[model samples]
Target: MRRKGSPHLVVIASDPADAHFCNVELRKLKTGAIVGRHYILRSDVQTFVSMYRRDGFSPVEGGNND
Candidate 1:
């Protein structure tokens, strides 16, 4: 998980040997515990992040450089 601001952003890709899948996890800032998790197709990552942004999560800059 990468620390952004109030929450930690974790984007986990499924096993390389299997079909491509992506899991996004939102973790609590204080305790580093998962607050929510979602399993989504790799193509939907942007849509998912957009929805979260609409719900008030700040965008993380620099893509996945962290």
Candidate 2:
């Protein structure tokens, strides 16, 4: 998994539904975008948001406005 910081491991889902949920989470952290983290819809909202910060994500309040 991404948390383990390993290159060989990938978090595989059981089906398309699971993949979609994972995609929601993955897309939140895609390309290291900060503000993007807010789009993650899940029960562990706090935990999910904290992971980004714990892994070195910066201020997520402001972003490009052009």
Question: Candidate 1 overall Cα lDDT vs. reference?
Answer: 0.60
Give Cα-based local distance difference scores for all models.
Answer: 0.60, 0.35
Candidate 2 residue lDDT tens string, 1-66: 244442221122223454324222233234443222223334444465466558754332343210
Q: Residue 1's C-alpha lDDT in candidate 1?
A: 34
Q: lDDT tens digits, residues 1-66, model 1?
A: 354344566544453554566767776666868778877777776787677667666545554411
Model 2: lDDT to the true structure: 0.35
For candidate 1, report its TM-score.
Answer: 0.60
| TM per prediction | 0.60, 0.30
Candidate 1 Cα errors over 4 Å, as ranges: 1-19, 61-66
